[model samples]
Target: MKRIPKSLLKKLENRKEIGTFRTLKTKTALVDFSSNDYLGLARLDAISVRAKQILTDLGHSANGSTGSRLLTGHHPLFKKVEQQIATYHEAETALVFNSGYDANIGLFSALPQRNDLVFYDAFVHASIRDGLRLSRAKSYSFRHNDFEDLARKIEKLTSASSVWVVTEAVFSMDGDSPDWKSLAAICNRFEVHLIIDEAHATGVLTQLTEIYKQTTIENHLTARVVTFGKALGCHGAAVLGNASLRDYLINFAGSFIYTTALPPAALATIAAAYEKLQDKIGLESLHQNIDIFNRSVVNLDLKQHFILSQSAVHCCIAPGNEHVKMLSMQFEKSGFDVRPILSPTVAARKERLRFCLHAFNTENEIESALKLLATLL
Candidate 1:
């Protein structure tokens, strides 16, 4: 084989220098705190059973989508899941994508026209950033959750081009939320379109949706992206918006157009998960666990150490990448699955230990984790 490229070697060296080189590891069987399966639906026996039945009922036993949705892979289950999502989220229409990444990339890359200007929160997800990277539109980052800075930037750009304000309902690393009410007002005053990425918020939809409902602005701003893999504890994602926006993405979003659709079994599980959550068993338990986790954080006096988050995701900032990784190993050793958010993924000083709470996490686990955190932090 030819010698490894010098440029690639240099890139690896730079990653090592910053302590941000990446590797993959099989999941350790530990108490849950790392995975995005907030409601524990990922491994729920009921979901699996329902998925099996859905596959049986469909009379199709395929193992894959086999082709892009635009070609031979538009499964009937796709329509079923998309319809359920639209109804559940109260959107005029819904278009499902392979994953949250695909949904964000497809929407961001295609929706903004050449003359448009995109104003995104500085801390939006990496996929959103990647999508923005591929777009022809001029894009600028406003200070994270700083509505005033966002307003000023919007004012500067609105006259020259159509504007889109993009933000996540809950930031992944920081476990914080944008000032959506103020953001909506600013977007309305400037006649700018507003888009929200609800990947983190999907776990606590009632709370987040209430915020949206209370916003002073009445006009349809733009769109909202919700993913199932996080809170829904399943797979896939959906873009929620007016019928026209959905149509536009179908026509223009290359990520959606060119990618193979999710398997029918996956779609069935999504529907089953939502159906289950709507009833009291799973949803109520998840809410109760969130409450328990919050109280534990407070009781342990670890509140000062953690980012204030009402959602299932919580974080304790541990400045350097090395420090955070070491702390995560300690967590793992103690039988927890917490993960470190390293620099380059986040900014240098903003590294953190992310604890993803799940409904199935016992009170003992929550208390034990917090007690450990109190000692560690």
Candidate 2:
């Protein structure tokens, strides 16, 4: 075997200094304040049973996508789900990808040409950064959610090249959202292509259709990317755009072309999940839970400790890596599956405990968790 290099070891050492090392774990039997299953679809027996029925009905008993989507892997479920998603989100078309990461990589690496310029929020997700890194376009970051700074940067870039403006609908860590209408207006004024990654927003927002209708600054927008892994509690993602963008991606987007299609079961699950979203009563219950969680935070006086948010995800700042980890352990001991967002994942000094709110979380559990948090902080 070839010897392991010491330089790679040094990189690991650097991560430790900043208190940002990654680890995996087994499932914990706790009241979840840290899962992305906001609507409880991931755990629903009905969804699973329906997915199985879908598979049996379609006679797609295969365990794998036999080839890339361009070849034999493009199943009928893909078309059905794509059209359903497009109609749900009120877009001209929708293209499904294997996952959120793949969708972001495919879009960023392929859409931006060498002469194009990309401007993104400084605090956008790592997947966006990775995608940008793979592109030939000149890219720069604006201050996080600072539209004025973004406008200035865009103005400068637009004079030299076509501009692509990007940001998340809701920031994953900060638990806040960019002003979509205002930002989209700015993109319109500059005649730039606007793109939003709705990975964290799709199932959480009641006004998603209104937001989508308003998110477009003009006709220049290439697309919006929405993922199911987070709020939808399923496993795949879709890029929503016009017919041309879909066709172009089919031909380009190396990540889309080079990877195997998602399993037929997964696609069926995604479809059924969307169908369930039409149940107004359930979505309302999820919103009520979010309200209850926020109220609990206020009652415990932990509001000041938390980042302001209306989404299912809430965050409480703990400052240092050691501090966040310690607090997270306390929650774990008390039977909550809260996660610690360490530095490098976020920035230094911004380490936090992230609580992912879910519809099924009882009022008692929500209050107890906040009470525990108050004691810890």
Candidate 3:
């Protein structure tokens, strides 16, 4: 076998020196504060039962989707689940992808032409940035969640046949959201096509309602990338838009064209998870935990150390990578699963302890975790 090149080894050495060396760890029984199962649907027995029922009903006994969707892998469940997702999200159609990364890569790389311009939020997920890099369109990023800066940048664009703007509904790391209304107004005024990644916000923001119905900007959005892996605790993603956009992606997106489809069981699980989103108890409990977390931060006077967010993800800044990693270890010792966000995942001196709250996390757990964090700080 060939050994790794010296340049790659040097990069690994740099990561170690900077305290950002990466390693995979097995899941522990520590009190959950790290996983993306925000609604706790991944462990829900009812979802498993329904998913099994779905597979049985479809007579899908296959272990894998033997080919890509364009070939033999386009299972019957795909149409059923895609329609369900479209209806739930209030879109004309939905195109399922293997994952959120696939959806972003497909949409951004295939949709935007050479004469187009894309302006994205500075802090969007790396997937979006990578997609933009593959696109023929010119792309630039504005300050994080700053619509005014976005407008200024757009105004400075000399010549572009079309304009597109991108942002996330709930930023994964910061757990904060942009001003949707303001962003919509800008897009509307400028006739800019808008794309929003709703990976973290999918089930959390609108458990009982469609996301389109919750905001006035629904009609203004050109596309919405939603993932089932986060709050839904499923294993796929979808791009929701008009029928034409879905058709275009099917015909042109390389990622979707080349990759094998998700297995029948994964699709069934995603469908079951969508149905589980209608349960008010989980949504209510998750929101309540978020509220408890906020209040505890305020009571402990730790609000200043954390980012202001209404989402299930709350980040408490701890600066240097070494410092933040140490704090995470402290939390682990206290039987919590909080993790550190290191650079260049984030900027230098902007590393943090990322706390992901979940529906199953009790008020006692919330309070205790915050108290421990406060003491450690």
Best by lDDT: 3
For candidate 2, lDDT tens digit of each residue in 1-377?
98679998888888777667666798889888888888888888788888888889987657887889999899888988899999988889999998899999999988888999999999898888999999999899999999999988877655546788899888888878987777877877888887888898877775866765667653656788999998778899999999999999899998899999998888989988887776642567778888998898888788888888988889999999999999999999989999999887888888899988888888898888889989888
Candidates in order, TM-scores: namely 0.94, 0.95, 0.97
lDDT of candidate 1 over 1-377, digit per residue (tens): 89799999999999988788998989888998888887777788998898889889889858888888889888988888888888877677889999999999999999888999998999999999999998999899999889899888877665546788898888888777876667777866788788889998785655665667778432645788999988787889999988899889988999999988888878888888878767634567667887898888888878877888877778888899999999998988998888999877888888899988777888889889888988888
List residue ranges in candidate 1 displaced over 4 A: 1-3, 216-218
| Candidate lDDT (C-alpha), each | 0.83, 0.85, 0.90
Best by TM-score: 3
Candidate 3 per-residue C-alpha lDDT over 1-377 given as tens digits, one digit per residue, 9 for 90 to 100: 99899999999999888677899999999999999999999889999999999999877569998999999999899999999999887779999999999999999999889999999999999999989999999999999999999989999995999899999989999999888668777877788888999999998988312444555577668899999989998788999999889999999999899999998999999989988875553898899889999999999999999999899999999999889999999999989999999988988889999999999999898899999988889
Off by over 4 Å in 2: 1-3, 13-18, 214-220
TM-score (C-alpha, index-matched) for candidate 1: 0.94
Stretches of candidate 3 off by over 4 Å are: 207-215
